[model samples]
Target: MARFNGTMVALHSPRMNGRGKLMFSRAVLLCLFLVLSSLPVADADAEQQSSEKALREHYDLQEGKRLYGEYCRFCHGEQGKGHAFNVTPPPADLTSPAVQRKSDIELAQTIHEGERGTAMGSWKWALSKEEKQYVLLYIRWLAQSR
Candidate 1:
């Protein structure tokens, strides 16, 4: 029997054993399995969110903006839409999906080693590794803001 909202309801199972106990243990086990299986997925999502938050805290967006202004703005423009200069093939639009889809390491490498056949020169000699990361963070912010 089960009580719900001040009402008692009889719980019956036609497939009960001789002891008068419901033979629905498999159903209970299945429900338990489903619930337990979902726990790891929830934990993974929470972990991902926390890691992203940590990354955000680790980087300074203000410094990134400053670096962008000093080094990247001449080509990428104030909004990072690119094509600010009249160069052939033009600079990559930092806010575009194609650029945004690139991994941080790839973008960082590009910043460290300038692309061939383009006006984008290497910043390896100019900015430190940390500064390059800051610039990457600013690029991500640009994509989001757009």
Candidate 2:
């Protein structure tokens, strides 16, 4: 990628004529397109691999709910609202679009890893991967319904 300009520039001298320059320009553009387009395919492939890994390692949705109830319900509330706690800056409203705006990885990390120096404990050690997915699913479901 770094050397792409050098490669294209090198093509200029040998292709000085109008048609040669046009062909060279097309080739350069094609090369750039191929390089750029290849990135998305690689990214897509990585996403698929990660998703497959998650599915193979953690696909049980119910278990996630159960774990959420045991670990999160007290803080997040039965309905996933911020009402469960009486402490400062009450738990987040899982049903809120604000909360829902966060990405899955963010939610998963917050749940699995837990917030530091607060009531949120690391469920990463306590719950299985499947349970985490269920919790996330329940959170998403609650958010949508709200």
Candidate number achieving the greatest lDDT relative to the actual structure: 1
Question: What digit string (tens of lDDT, one per residue) describes model 1 on residues 115-144?
Answer: 999999999999999999999999999999
**Against the hidden reference, what TM-scores do the models get?**
0.61, 0.54
Highest TM-score against the true fold, candidate: 1
For candidate 1, give the lDDT of residue 60.
Answer: 82
- Provide the lowest-lDDT 10-residue window in model 2: 1-10
Clashing pairs in 2: 64-131
lDDT at residue 102 of model 2 (Cα atoms): 93
- Per-residue lDDT over 38-142 for candidate 2, one digit per residue giving the tens place of the 0 to 100 score: 999999999999999878545455566677788889988988997988976577888988889999989889888887766666888887776777788888877
* Model 2 root-mean-square deviation: 10.9
